[model samples]
Target: MDEQQLSAAQLAEAGLDDWRQILGRLKARFRTGDPATGFALANAIGQAAAAANHYPDLTLTGADVVVTVSSPDGPGITRRDADLAGEISRLAARLGATPDAGGLTQLELGLDTAAGTRLGPYYAALLGGEVTDGEPVDRSGQVPTVWWQDPSEDNDGPALPAQPFEQRWHFDVWVGHDEGERRLSAVLNAGGRLVSDAAAPAYWVVEDADGNRSCICTPTGR
Candidate 1:
């Protein structure tokens, strides 16, 4: 086992039923009855993070407090995050908070660029995001994360050179397996083109009329 990172199976064993691990982060939502309660929980979470020396992407709005934890230098959840999550869960229990499992959704940008090392900083600066491991992410948990991909070896084959963002940057809409098809049809109805379904039930490559791409993905049946 890596000393810095914890695998998905280990995260599960750490009693993190309230949290969901996806896209190299462990995300969980705590539902409060009111805004005041929400803010209180968020504050407590901040204190907990400080104590653990591991901060989460904590967001509080209306009646929900969303927390995302991960190691800055490791893949997915780490031992530090799992321990912090345990602390947060205990604090949440004391505050009468309940888990909001369905409130989580993650977005990632797939940019086909050979010069990922060069373009990453530009997009990170442009989007007010931070670059980590050559990927740009919204560390505040407010915006979709952007990651670069080499289109030279994708299932879609070689990518074409483009004048602008079209055909290069696309979205990866992470959804539950149960909701994948519904979302796919909705996008198609919204005038998005089906680029490829060769990897269906796992991911479906989609494109807009202008050639921008997005994939509808599910967690199961992969």
Candidate 2:
């Protein structure tokens, strides 16, 4: 990692209690209680970002404001992100806003394929994003990232033959480690079945009754 790039541990040590590192971005939600307050905070955040020459993606809902910050020129969190997180927290505090850490989550799309390199460009173009390190990433954060799982790369063996009826795509829903089990339980209660838990604390594969699958993921193992 570069000296400027911050790891998860460094981000925690920075005393940013209101923020969480999700999907390589520093994300946080502030409860504004009403649309008026949400807009005010959004405007304040915009001004702060403009002054620092670093912008964060801001979403203002009817009762909350979601802020996601990342280094524009890099792929991971950096010192500037931590600084801005602190400033945003302070601003929210002054406005009597409360941080809702539990509301943060990130969704990513995963494709199981033998020809990742060949199919990457097609998905990237369709999603209006670019392929970075074998994954399609939407810089605007408007769409979930698309990653590939190439079975052939597992043990230097030949690529496995594609099955006509196999499920080729799935979703990887990332949440805080502490929130993993609750999410899994919710899925089960909603008619989803546990497909696998061999990777507990990191991820668990769950499938809907019809067989569509999604993995509830956390940062614990990877």
Candidate 3:
């Protein structure tokens, strides 16, 4: 099977249970400013589940907690991983949490969406990001991920998260120097700030509008 196609045991390792509890703890601990970001994140979770056609276990937190990407369904960053991370990125956008690129604290970037619609307006509305102005859009991921249904058309799943931030591992996004600048520009425009920068040819640390940090570098730099 592909990297995302995992056996039942692999799915089990992703923590199907207590998803809300984890999210809640994260929210309580981090106290991200925007509370609605949690719901936006919830909607994003539903969106990803819809797209992947697979549901991730979540801990209930009265509409304040949900599962994140990072929980791998397979070994290595497979197609599924990219897809999942993309979903989270798109969803986090809605909550004002874009990719940090540098100083990453969590890396949830693998999911496999065997089914679901790639062009979903609801997801766009939730994310507040337009669909690239018609570029023959496929799935909206720089990576491969899955969703159970499209958030725009989805009316099912764990509902929205009650708050922002969650328990998970951080991830770093690698890119070329030019791409790094572009990403940083977008992040800056989105309300993300530059957290750190390396002396290398192409390396930077950025925080999303929500304050999550991640690294950015060229592909070769990776």
Top candidate, metric lDDT: 2
TM-score order, best first, reads 2, 1, 3
RMSD versus native structure for model 3: 20.9
Cα-based TM-score, every candidate: 0.73, 0.86, 0.28
What does each candidate score in C-alpha RMSD?
Answer: 4.4, 3.7, 20.9
lDDT of 3 by residue, 1-222 (tens): 345443434533644221111111111111124556666566667777878865443333433443434333322333354455445545555566433223212222311232223543444445444444321222333332212322345443223323256422234554423356776787789888776665333456666666555555542232
Question: Over the stretch 1-222, how does candidate 1's per-residue lDDT look in tens digits?
Answer: 324676546766888878776666777889987998888888899899888777788778898888888877766667778888888988888999898765476787778887887888888888888788887776666678787777565544334334355466678988644456777788899999777776777778787787777787765543
The count of backbone overlaps in candidate 2 is: 0
Q: By TM-score, is 1 or 3 better? A: 1
The whole-model C-alpha lDDT of candidate 1 against the native structure comes to: 0.76
Best by TM-score, which number?
A: 2
Model 1 clash pairs?
none
Stretches > 4 Å off in candidate 3: 1-32, 55-74, 101-222
Any runs in candidate 1 off by more than 4 Å, and if so which?
1-4, 129-138, 154-166, 175-202, 206-212, 218-222
Supply candidate 3's per-residue lDDT for 208. Answer: 66
lDDT of each: 0.76, 0.83, 0.42
For candidate 1, the per-residue lDDT at 120 reads 80
